[model samples]
Structure formats: C-alpha cells, structure tokens
Target: MTIVAEPQFHVLAVDDSIIDRKLIERLLKTSSFQVTTVDSGSKALEFLGLVEQEEEEQQQQQTSSTSGLSSYHQEIEVNLVITDYCMPGMTGYDLLKKIKESSSLKNIPVIIMSSENAPSRISRCLEEGADEFLLKPVKLSDMKKLRPHILKGKCKDQQKQHQKITCSIDITAAPSPTLVAGSASKRKSMEDDTLAPQRTRARFSSETLTVII
Candidate 1:
C-alpha cells in the first residue's frame, strides 16, 4: 500500500520583532505548519496580494508615468494569518480590518497575538472578525486551537459548494406532477425545514466570540 502525507497548511506570520518572528516560525514549523514570516503588516498585505485601494489610487496619480500597469493578484492561498497586534506602521488590528474587508481574502482565518491581555481590545478584535486572539508568548497548546479554525474555514467553503449543488439538483430533479400537486403542503414544509437551519446558523454566528486568552 502506498501512503501519502497530508498537505501542510500555509500560515502567514507578521511581526515587527525579529525574535518573535523567529519564535513563531519555529513554533509553527514544529507544529507541522508551513510558515512565512514578515516584519510588517504592510508586507503581509503585499504577500497576500492586497493593497489599500486608496493608496493604490494615490500611487497611480503620483507615479502613473513611471510605473506600468498594476495588478492585485494573489499568488498563494494562505490558509491562515497569525500577526502581532502591535507593530510600527500598521497594527495587527488594522491588518485584520484589511483582510476582513477584502472580498477575496476575507474568508482566510486570522489570529491576533498581543502581549497585553486587554479585554476591551480583545472584544474589539473579535468583533472585527479575528478568528482567535492569543496572549503573547504563544505556546504549542495555542497552536492546537489553530487547526479547528482552519478546518472550519474549509468546511464553510465546502458547505457553500454543497448548497449550490443541492440547489441545482432540486431545480433539475423536480418532483412528478402528481406528487407535486398532492404534496404541495408537504413540499412547503420541507422547504421550511431546509431554511430553518440556515437561519439558526446565522443567529449562532452572531453570538459573541469565546475569549481564548
């Protein structure tokens, strides 16, 4: 029998401190994740193939003659982003906002790490769409929390695809005319049943994030 190894998850780690960057890289590697470390949040955006639209427009106005055409293409699919909350130029909160605001990158999981255990800041980050917030000096145990979030992201994408497929099948595989006429009320009930879970999920997501710090 041939055995194949599972593909490693790719993570983008952003921090201003070289020591912390090295530490995170080492930890993630030891946890069997493929890690890319950047020294700044802006660089993280660039690595993710994103730029503020306003900044790009300003650059175009200032240097249109000197520069060629621009592209906002993502070169890699990063499963997760782990960033330090405090940085020189763009704080991790700002980076988190950028990622969540982007249509293409919004689905990727983002984790914020801070040395300070500020509840208000944690609440703000969670409200801003951070998947997980970790207090500084992240441990191997914290690394375990990461896999669930990543798998959740993947499951969301799969659910969307499944929904699409189900919709298509329902449209094409219509019930027999006799059955449709006789079971109209039953069909309505089934439709209601199908939609109820979706509404429940929406409500469940609105619930506050559990603080892991």
Candidate 2:
C-alpha cells in the first residue's frame, strides 16, 4: 500500500511587530503548520482574498497598466488566522469581524493574541467569533488550542460539502412536476443518482472515513 501524506494546514499570522511575527511564525512552524505571516490585518485580508473594492480596483488598474503583471489573491486554503489584537490601522477584533462578515471566509477559524489580559477584551474577541484568545509571548503550550479550531473548521466544511452532495442527489432523483424535460434530462438525472454514491464512496474510503469520524 502506498502511504499518502497528510496535507499541512495553512495558517495566516497577522502582527504589526516584526519580532512577534517571527516568533509566532516559528511557533506555528514548530507545530507543523504551514505559516504565512502578514504585517497588518489589512494585508491579512488581502492574502485571504478579502480585499476592499477600492484596493481591488487599484490593483486591477495597476495590472492593466503594467505588462505581464498579475494580481492573485489567496491561492491556498487558510485553515486558521492568528492575529495580534493591537495592530495599527486594523486591529485583530476588526479582522475577526471582517472574517465573520464574509460568507466565503467566515468558516475559517480565527485566534486573537494580546499582551494585555483585559477581561473585556477577551470577552469581546470571543463574542465577535474569535476561536481563541492567547496572551502575548505565546508559548508552545498555547499552540495546542490551534489544532482543535482548525479541525473544527474542517469538520464544518466537510459537513457542508456532504450536505451539498446529498442535495444534488435528492434533486436529481426526485421528479419535478413543473419542469418539462425530455428523456436526455431523465437519463442524466438517473446517471447522477446512480453515480453520486459511488463518487462519494471513492472520495472517502474506509480509512478516510475512519479518520474523519
């Protein structure tokens, strides 16, 4: 049997301090996560493909003016976002709100870190949908909280995908009264109904299912 290597989870770490950014990057790498560090929450948003319309328009203009220039955003999946709570311009709480507000990116987990142990700040971050709040000078022990949030996000994504698959199967199998379709539609629907389960089974083998469960 050929052993398949597990894909590494990607993390986006946002911090204004260069020292803190390096430290967090090192800690995340040591924990076996693929890390991408950004200096500000705005930069983090850009990395995650959540750029504002004005900036997007500017990038488009720049790309048009420059030959062979391409502006690509977020080519990889970011499993988690760990940001410093006190960044200039866009704070971590602001970043969390932006993530939570977005339909496509809201499901990704976010963690907030700060040097101050203010109760109100912690509560506010958690209330605003931050998965965890870590104190500054984050330790390896604090890294343990990261995995659970990533796994939770993964599970949620899988559940949504499964639901979509099930819905597709149901729609193809069920007969619609209002629709006036020919044999070709019926045949395709039958094919979909027949093949959906097999495709799902192939995608999630016994071992994969076991691991997920």
Give the number of the best model, judged by TM-score.
2
Question: In candidate 1, residue 131 scores what lDDT?
Answer: 97
lDDT of each: 0.68, 0.69
Across 1-213, the per-residue lDDT of candidate 2 in tens digits comes to 122224567889999999999999988766557899999989898787767755654654544211112246645778899999997899999999998987667888999999999999999999999999999889975876776677667667667666442322222234432121122332343335324543221111111211111
Give the clashing residue pairs of candidate 1, or none.
none
Which candidate number would show the highest lDDT if scored against the true structure? Answer: 2
TM-scores of the candidates are 0.66, 0.67
On residues 1-213, what C-alpha lDDT tens digit does candidate 1 reach at each position?
211123467899999999999999988876657789999999998877666686765534443211111233343468899999999999999999998987556778999999999999999999999999999999865876776677677667557556442221122133322111112242353335323533221101111121111
Q: How accurate is candidate 2 locally (lDDT)?
A: 0.69
- RMSD per candidate (Å) reads 15.2, 14.4
